[model samples]
Target: MTMIFGIPIQAFLGQLLVGLINGSFYAMLSLGLAIIFGLLRIINFAHGAQYMLGAFIGYLLLADLGIGYWPALVLVPLIVGLFGMAVERFALSRLYGVDQLYGLLFTFGLALVIEGVFRYYYGVSGQPYAPPPLLSGGTNLGFMFLPNYRGWVVVASLVVCFGTWALIERTRLGSYLRAATENPRLVQAFGVNVPLLLTLTYGLGSGLAGLAGILAAPVYQVSPLMGSDIIIVVFAVVVVGGMGSILGAIVTGYVLGLAEGLTKVFYPEASNIVVFVIMALVLLVRPAGLFGRDG
Candidate 1:
């Protein structure tokens, strides 16, 4: 068996695949965070809860409503995204002119409330969610076997990430969003509904989180604690990538995920701390983050 860096090639490949899978999640989650923060300037602490809601909603649809994964993929995000728009309109919108901490605290409290409500009903146990029938099997690649669902996740995430990037960087609507972020008053003067834009942006960000949650439902158990467990690592990814930087968030997420996976192969003990260590190093070198602009 061929070996790379003293590790078996198969093992290395396996870990690399796992890293890419994980990186997909990180990229999706952090991408949402970047979008929300970029335009709204609000640190959305409730994002994880929104993700949990997505998975739970998907599970409920499958179990009770008889909706399959394919449909839920479309419905769940829409539902959650609309819900998020409502949240911004009723709650978050009230804090726009207030201190930034107010927005943060509101989201943090919202997270706790959401988690508490789910825990009260679900009892903290992981609910099982099976992948769709069409994606249930594995594919053999001679060297490493790839799960069809996992592969779909990686591809879907990449599509979503790049698609979002293109939408923001290349599209006319994206131009308005960027303009509003820079000067909401000026954009409003041009008859572009700035408040509506903010609401939609938050909704879009939350919807992305929901989409990620639905994708993760089959891979990880649909549990209320799932979001909390992953959100910290994602936050570290955001910090390293530079908060509010769309491209930075995407790149950092994948890079850190691969780094973490490699760490697990080389030094199992430090696997957990590797991301944090890297975050600390990034902070020391560039406090604004790898892609963050020094303000």
Candidate 2:
């Protein structure tokens, strides 16, 4: 019966929850984009397809092979990562020395082929992916009733996002990745296999996308088209975050998500456009995003 700013408190909380859930996906996808763009200077249009592949792989593992979610979570990314590595090796690697536009175009064509193939086989309809048994229920959190699956999603995504940030910003492997990003020739001269590092980085980025897809499967419909639908919004998030910074990607995603949720409560009409609007504002003011370093 209580209301906050003339909206039912429950409704407000619910929308906020939805926003956070959407934000989790945005964070993961944009993080991958940042990684690729910062290092390889490629705008990978096929990331959405990679995400779809992740979900499809997870579903196939469960429905056909009788594998469960826990294991699928681990295996799906590895599978998707290998696929990404192969794409980079055979297809994308050739374009590295050329104009960056070529990289974009190549990935865009690859995205189309991937999405078209999946649509041909699976159609555009959504498929349900049930949450694991342990995450199917909800908890009464006094102020809000939270679904276990959603809670798990937020927590798991936070862990992955921060963990990745730490690994890249703090660890020795991260140092190499950064070094490769900054000066590949120098890093190569130092005996770090730069090309292999690039491949691994691409695989790692794509694998993160896959992991996100697996997390999203139970929360959203598992459909071939799901990736395309969300990818645009994520791209906007990346733009607003500025592609140079990893932490910026993570922060932008969660912030925009909460902003969208608040907008839905205050003015439903603006919720969809809020992200783009923020991106425009960021371009006008900072031009490098909240946490981005000037390139």
For candidate 1, lDDT tens digit of each residue in 224-253? 998898889999999999989999999998
Off by over 4 Å in 2: none
Best by TM-score: 1
lDDT of all predictions, in order shown?
0.94, 0.90
Listed per model in order, the count of residue pairs whose N, CA or C atoms clash below 3 Å is 0, 0
TM-scores vs. true structure, each candidate? 0.98, 0.97
lDDT of 2 by residue, 128-221 (tens): 9999998999999887899999999999999999999998899999999989978889999999998898899899899999999999999988
> Which runs in model 1 stand beyond 4 Å of their true positions?
none
Output the lDDT of residue 233, model 1. 92
Report the lDDT of model 2 for residue 270. Answer: 97
Q: Give candidate 2's whole-model lDDT.
A: 0.90
